[model samples]
Target: MEVAFSGINIYSKKPEAVFEFYKKLGFRVLEEVAPDDKWYGSTLALQDGDNAPIIWIWRQSDEDNSVVCNHFVFSTNGKMDEVYESIVAAGIACKPPFTAVWGGRELILHDPEGNELLFL
Candidate 1:
C-alpha cells in the first residue's frame, strides 16, 4: 500500500471569516465549491506555495459535527521571521517565535475559529 498526505479539512462555523484569515497568511484560493443536495457544506481549497498541501475550509453543515485538534504545523521555508511580521501586521495575535525543545524554530497563532496554527 502507498499513501501521501495531500490536504486537511477544517470545518468552521464561519467559513468565510476563516478563509479570509488564511488568505492573510498567504494562502491562495485555488477553487471554491458550494454545497449541494449531495454534499455537506461549501468549501474553499487553498495553497500557500508550489507543491504545498492544500487546505480545505468547509462551512459546517451540522453544528455538532465540527472537528477540532491540538494544532497544525506549516513549514515556513526559512522565512519564519517574515511570516511572523506579516501575521503581526495583519493584527493577528501570535506568540513570538522561539526555539522548540527539538531545536526547531516556531511561531504559534490561532485562526479566526480558534484553530491553532504553528509556523516552522
Candidate 2:
C-alpha cells in the first residue's frame, strides 16, 4: 500500500469570503473545481512553486457530511505583528494575540465557514 497526503479541504458556506480571508494571509487561489461551483464553492491552493505542498479548501454545506478539520497554521518570517494589523484592518474577530511556550506569537480566528486559522 502507498499513502501520501495531498491537501486539506474545508467546507464553508462562504468559501470566497474564506478565500479572501486567507488571501490576506498569503494564499493564492489556483482554480475553481466546478462550473456551477457556486453551490459547492471552490478549491483553493497555496503554491509558492518550490515543491511546497499545496492546501485545498472547498465550499460546501456541513448539514450532513462532516469530519475533522483542524485549524491551519502559518509560519511567518517576522511579521506576526503585521498579521495582527491585518486582522484588525479586516475587522475580523480574532482571539487575542499572544506568545506561545515555544516563544512564538500566535493568533486564532474563524473563517465564515467556521474553520480556524492559527497564525504563528
Best by TM-score: 1
Cα lDDT tens digits for candidate 1, 1-120: 786677778877677778778877766667666544323333334455555677777667663665686488778899999988988898777878999999999898888878888888
Q: Which parts of model 2 have CA positions greater than 4 angstroms off? A: 1-5, 33-41, 61-67, 101-103
> Model 1: residues >4 Å from true position, as ranges?
33-51, 62-66
In angstroms, the error of model 1 at 2 is 1.6
Give TM-scores for every candidate, taking all chains together and pairing residue i with residue i. 0.73, 0.67
How would you encode candidate 2's per-residue C-alpha lDDT over 1-120 as one tens digit per residue?
A: 886556776666566676677666556767656534756544455666645456566666647566555677776557878878877876666767898899878887877666677877
Clashing pairs in 1: none
Candidate 1: clashing residue pairs, number: 0
Model 2 is weakest, by summed lDDT over 10 consecutive residues, at: 35-44
